[model samples]
Target chain A: MQVNGVEIEDTFAEAFRMVGSRILITACSRQWALQAATTMTGFATSVIGCGCEAGLEREVEPEETPDGRPGTSVLLFAMSKKSLADQLIKRIGQCVMTSPTSACYNFLESSETVLVGGKLRYFGDGYQISKLLGGRRFWRIPVMEGEFLIEESFGVQEAVGGGNFLILGQDLESTLRATERAVAEIGKVRGVITPFPGGIVRSGSKVSSKYKFLRASSNTPYCPTIRSLVDSQLSEAVNCVLEIVIDGLEKTEVGEAMRVGIRAACLPGIVRISAGNYGGALGQYHFYLRDILGGTLG
Target chain B: MDKVILRLKERSNIPVEAEAICPDLFLTKSQQEIEELALYYGNKGRRLGDFFQVQGERSDNIVIEGEIPNFKKIGQGMSRGNIHIQGDVGMHLGALMKGGRILVEGNVSDWLGAEMEGGSIRVKGNAGHLVGAAYRGSSRGMRGGEIIVEGDGGSEVGELMRRGLIVIGGRAGDFVGAFLIAGTIVVLGPVGLRPGAGMKRGTIVAFQEPDLLPTFHYNCLCQLSFLRIYLHHLREEDLNIPQEYLGGFYKRYNGDTLELGKGEILVWAGQVA
Candidate 1:
């Protein structure tokens, strides 16, 4: 199938089953809220190297937050429940607690939860005060600036990660433009996050590598410079490629994000849209490119 | 058909022990059985039918219509359902209640909701002393629940409360929140002397300047995020909290140094930051 002159590859994007959580970081002002959210999601591009994948979901209005302050919501995903819990404690404790006039709260509601503030309360050094309001417990730890408040637990649930699509173009600028458009469109999809830098990954990786120590290596088939040396998947007209990876709280949301992203990436100079997979093995979720593009865009 | 109402037959000056008037106990009994339930009228074993007229039963919703200032233990140890009182009620109104709601349209005497583990009690008029407090020798009072009084409250409110929320929308008498272990007491009007006197760990919020014990020391003048959240929650609960109070700074006083020194009393400082 083709969409706006761009060929749609008959393949699927393989996504692994993971655990995810959403947290709200509120501060005295919008600037501080964004700063804390940005800092908490830093260096969290991929689970392979970063131990988790995280990104800012959206900016929340003061009226929508628990503390009636400007805030932002962030989504984090990890391969295991234990890893997700550990990452929450480390990132929230080090990044959010240290930010000025900041407070963190669990935005998601699930039966299963991980103790975040319950463990971070130790930072109070025997001075933390707990408040139970309307069945929810919050801890207030005195800080140099005043006090930092956080919810005692955060909800975590099964999620999908590595929902991605690749944009192949005739040139570098056109490919980057298409990739950016795709990212901008994907941002409108709730419960999903594009974890890579600028929401675009220039160096996509393959599962196998020549080095024994490396679990993944660069996608040599899509590399333009060594097109003649490797078994290239790209046509002679295609010169550059960029990938947009998505992690979402649900499989349907991930598929919806991929559908919008692929449709938005089918702009001028873009040659084809393809996805990465391991011969229909490995991951539990698979987003078929043609199947997703066949549906109507919301 | 909406309720199991009990209308008083006559005005009684003698105290009545009506512990069997709980919604949990009446949920499965017939109207005749509910009237047949026992009660103690001034130390004499009596029938509930001898004092009140019972209507509609086998439900968890109860309504009492009378000014029984001598009726005690009305909803004692109830776990679920609702009880709506339309007149003045005596002491131990909801003592040791675990779950459900008790809404009073008139005044309540002392020991209201004492030692309640869970549930909520809302009074539209004044409440006597020891509201949500521990019994004479119990270690903890009001382990979990909420008590919202829209009118004046007597002395020693929320004393020894371990975990819960007590909101007094009007003026509070002396020794409010004394010996609080872990809970919150919010008095939206002027409070009496020695608030949070011997609190080990708790919070007491006074809208007007309060006379505190000498052991409490001035801490800081700053914004409290938790207070904003709590006030917002109270607003949702239909409490008439001002918008400025939800976004204002408070005078934090670290007190009860005679005890743990972790307790704090936050007096509203208007809109100043």
Candidate 2:
């Protein structure tokens, strides 16, 4: 299959199960809200190195937030529930708690929950105040800037991580531009995030490496510089490649994101769109490129 | 969705122990069965049929229309469903209620919503003393749920409250939020004397200048973001919150130094400030 002259690979993107949570951080102003969100999600790009993966989901309007202030929604993903909770407690305590006039709330209401403010209330020493409103409990901790209000707990559920697609272009500039467009489009969807810096990954990797210490190595088959030296998957026309990775709250959202991103990446000078996988050996979720593009899976 | 309406046939001078008139009691019984239910008039055990006229079938929704100023325990220990009272109600209107909602269209007597664990109570008129307060020896009061008073409230409102919210739209009498352990009390009107006394941890927000207790020390004056969220929640409950208060700063006083000294009293600074 092809879209806008870009060939669609027949393979699928393999995604592993992850535990994720969404947090809403509202502040005195939009700038402060974005500041806190960016700080909290910073350095969280991949579980392999960062211990977690997170990104800003969207900017929320004043009326949409719990505190009637401009806010931002962020999603954090980890390989296990324990790590997700740990990362959330550390990041929110250091980043959001220090932010001026900021408050945190659980964005999801699932039955499965993780302790957030319930545990962080220890920061207040013996001064923490708990208020129950509308059946939801919030903890108000005294801070230097006045008080920080956060929900007692946050909902957690199984999510899909490592959903990715490669954008192959004739040259570097075209590849970068197409990947940028794809990231911009995927950012519009809810319940998904591109954890990589600027929402694009240049070092697409294969399953394992020759070096015993490395679990993953660069994708040699798609590397243009060594295309002639190895069994290359790229055609002679393809020169540069950039991958856009997606982590979403559900498989359907990941599929939807992939569909939208692939369509947007199929722009001028783009040669093909392919997905990464371990040859169906690992990961429970298989997002077929054709099925996503053909609207067969929701 | 069944609705049972009980209209008053006569004004009972003697207080009636009407604890059996809750939604759970009428949810499964027929009108005749409900009428035959036992009740106490002072010291006499009489059938409910001797008092107000009963109508409708078994339902989770109950309506009581009467001059029932002497009716007690109107919704005691109610776990689920809704009760609408059209006139004055006696003491213990929703004592120890765990769930559901109670809407009082007229005045309510003392101990309204006392020791309530969960559910909501909205009073369209005045409420007597100890609304949402614990009993004299109880450790906690109104652990969860909400109580919104649209009119004046008598003394000791929210005393010893451990959790939940109490919103008084009109004047509040003395000892408001006294000995509050935790939770929030938002008084939209003038507050009486010694508010937040002995409070260990909680928030007392008053629109008018409360009769500040000597134990409270001036903390700071600033805009609180959480107040917006709390007031916004109240607005969702159909409480008429002044728009100016939502955007204005508050004069915070950290008080009850005699206790844990963690509680706060936020007095509205008004639009001019």
Candidate 3:
């Protein structure tokens, strides 16, 4: 199958099952809310190194927020429930609580929960006030600027991570442009986030590395400069490649994101749209490129 | 669900203790069984059928229609269901209610929702003294739940309240939230003297300037995000809240130093101190 003359690989993108949580960060203004959200999601790109994968999901309107303030919605995913809880407490307590005029709330509704503000209340040193309203408990911790309000618990549930598609283009400029367009289209999809810098990962890695200590290494087959020295997957005309990784609260959302992203990335000079996988093993979810574009499961 | 309605047949001068009028009790009883429920009329044993005419029954949804100004403890200790009162009710309405809702279309007398563990009580008319307050000897008042009074409230509202929210859309009488352990009381109109007296840890928000006690110390003038969240909740509850009140800065005053001194009274900075 081809989209805008770009070949759609028959292969599938492998994704692992994980746990995720959504946090709504509201502040005195949109700038402050974004500031806190960006800071909290910083250094969180891949769970292998950062212990979690996080990114800004979207900007929330003032009326949609709990405190009626401009807000930002962020999604974070981890390998286990405990890891997600630990990452939440550390990031929210350090990044959001420290930001001026910011309040954090549990944006997800699920049966399973993790204690967030209930534990962060220690920062108040016995001065924190607990408010139970409409069956939801919130903690008000006194800070230097003012009080930092946060919900007692955040809901967590099973999620899908590492949903991806690789953009193979004729040159660096074409590949980068196509990937940017794909990321912009993916941004409009809900419940998914591209947990990478500018939503584009240039150094897509393989499962194994040459170094014994390193569990994974760069995807040499997709590297344009080292094509002659490695088992390159590119053609004579292809010189650049970029990948967009997605993490979503559900498998269907991940599939939808990949579908939209691939459609947007099929510009001129784009060679093919492919996905990374380990022979359909290791991951629980797989998104078949041609099947997804054909509106059916492979 | 068929509602159990009790309409007053005759206006009684003597106060009737109607603790058995709770929805939890009437939930499984038939109309006849509900009418047979016992009551004390001025220390005299009487049947609920003696004064009020019972209608549909065996439902948690109850509707009481009449000027029951002499009836007390209407929904005392109720765990679940809904009670709708169309006329004025006497004292101790919804006291000790655990879960459910009570809607009073007319005025309610003293001790409304006293020591209620859970549930919600909405009074459209004015309320009598000690609303959501603990009994004279009890250490805690309303442990959980919510009480919203669209009209004025009597003195000592939410006294010794441990938890929950109390919103009075109009003026609150003296000593509002006095001896509060931990809770939130929002009075939209001017508060009476000595609000939050002896409160250990709680919040009393008064839109109008209040006559604060001597022990209270002014903290600072800043915008409280929690208050904004609370006001937004109140708006969802269909209360008429002004745009200014939702975003205005408040003058925080930590007070009742005679006790824990952790309690605070946030007076609206828009109003003159």
Candidate 4:
């Protein structure tokens, strides 16, 4: 498939299942709310090193929040249920609680299972108070700026992660340029997460086995496009392929992001592009690149 | 006071025990059942059906024509209902309601809204002491709910409240919100001496004047930006406050120094800081 004169490789992007939670952090102003949310979701790009994946889903107006204050909804994802609670407790207790005139609430799932505020209430010692309004429980912890109101708990549900597509280019600069455009376009996709730092991964990995403890290693098969007698997956003009993995609400959302990202990457100097999946062996969710960009999915 | 017309064609006032009457009860019940229930007055072991006359079965509302000064614990423990009393009622009105609303058209006795967990109560006239106060030996007061009084009230209003809100439009007697743990209470009229006497947490906003207790120390006077935000929020609600008070400054008093020092009394003193 050729999109805007760029060849679409007949490959598929792989994805796996993960748990996600959405939290709404509202403050006295939009700036303050953004400050608190940004701080809370900081250093949380990928589960590889950060133990979780978190991002600011959207900035909300006063009417959009439960307390009618300017707020931002942030989505936090983790590989396990325990880490989801662990990551939330640590970040919220540090970021939102420390921020002045700011508050946090449940933005996505509405239930009692995920304990965010309930865990942070310990900051108030025994003096911490709980108020149930219209059936939703809010913890009122006395802070320097009067009180901080946070929902007792957030709701958690199943989500998808590791959905990816690689953009192969001629050189390093060309690879970076095309990947940058793809990232910018794919960033507009909703209900999905790009957990990697800045939503772009430079060092893409391959499945296992240089060491006993190593689960995966770098992909060494597609190295360069130089004229040489070497076993490589690149043509004479092909040099590098940057990957854009997505984690969204559904497999279709991730597939849609791939379509937009690929369409945006079909520019000058970019050669044949493809995706790195487990060859139908690894991740449960499979988004065939050709099928997705060609507007078809099996 | 102007008489509030009560039609009782629907909903059974089946011995509605809380002190006041609210209209929401009539939405679901048949009128015949209410007339039979309103006459109920449970004393000692006697059933509440012994008090008033069973009138026409027309509306969920039951209007009492004469004074009902001896009724105690009216509309108690009601979950989804409304009651409208025409005359002065006895003590402990809306004692432990979980849901629904109660509106009293006349005066009421002591212990209004004591131990109320949920729902709302609005009294149009004067009430005796301990409105929204804790029961005899218990420390937990109204955990969640709202209480509004249009006229003067007796002492100990919101006495050991853990959560919920209480709004008094008229003067409140001494010791308002004595030991509030959490929640908010806004009084538009004069709050007599010793408000927030032993409060550990929660907020009290008096619109007129507050006779704060000596235990409450005057905190750093700053233009409370959050108050403007909170006031703006309240303004959007169906709150009954004058425009002058909404824009006024509140003397922020942080204490019940005697406790965890978490309680606050924001008196609307008509100044910016």
What tens digits encode model 4's per-residue C-alpha lDDT throughout B25-85? 4344444454344433343333223444444443434455556666567667777655677
Positional deviation of A169 in candidate 2, in angstroms? 0.5
Q: Report how far off residue B127 is in candidate 4 (Å).
A: 6.3
Chain B global fold similarity (TM-score) for predicted model 2 against the true chain B:
0.97
- Among all candidates shown, the one with the greatest lDDT: 3
lDDT of 3 by residue, B11-106 (tens): 888999999999889989999999999999999999999988999978999998889988999999999999999999999999999999999999
**What TM-score does each of the candidates earn?**
0.98, 0.97, 0.98, 0.79
Clashing pairs in 1: none
Give lDDT tens digits, candidate 3, residues A28-63. Answer: 899999999999999999999999999999999998
Judged by whole-model lDDT over C-alpha atoms, candidate 1 comes out at 0.94
Number of the candidate with higher lDDT, 1 or 3: 3
User: What is the DockQ of the complex in model 4?
Assistant: 0.18
Where model 2 places Cα greater than 4 Å from the true spot, the runs are B271-273
Candidate 1 per-residue C-alpha lDDT over B132-214 given as tens digits, one digit per residue, 9 for 90 to 100: 99999889988999999999999999999999999999999999989999899999988998899899889999989987789
**Which ten contiguous residues of candidate 1 chain A have the minimum total lDDT?**
A289-298
How far does residue B94 in candidate 3 sit from its true spot (Å)? 0.5
Residue B257 lDDT (model 2): 93
**Model 2 C-alpha lDDT per residue in residues A1-298, reported as the tens digit of each score:** 8899889989999999999999999998999999999999999999988999999999999989977889999999999989999999999999999998889999987889999999999999977777777778788888887889999999999999999999999999999999999999999999999999999999888877889989898999989999999899999899999999999998999999999999999999999999889988799899999999999762
Q: Write the per-residue lDDT of candidate 1 for residues A1-298, one digit (tens) a residue.
A: 9999899998899999999999999999999999999999999999989999999999999999988999999999999989999999999999999999999999999999999999999999999989998889999999999999999999999999999999999999999999999999999999999999989999999988999999999999999889999999999999999999999999989999999999999999999999988877799888888888777321
Q: What's the TM-score of chain A alone for every prediction? A: 0.98, 0.98, 0.99, 0.90
DockQ comparison, 2 vs 4, better candidate: 2
Query: Mind giving the per-residue lDDT tens digits that candidate 4 earns over A1-298?
Result: 7876788877777777888888888877899999998898889876877988887777889877665578988888888888989999999999988998788887675443588899899888876766555466778777776677788888887778888877778887987888888888887887776766677887787787669998877676665633364456778677676777777766677788888888888888888778887778767888887888678852
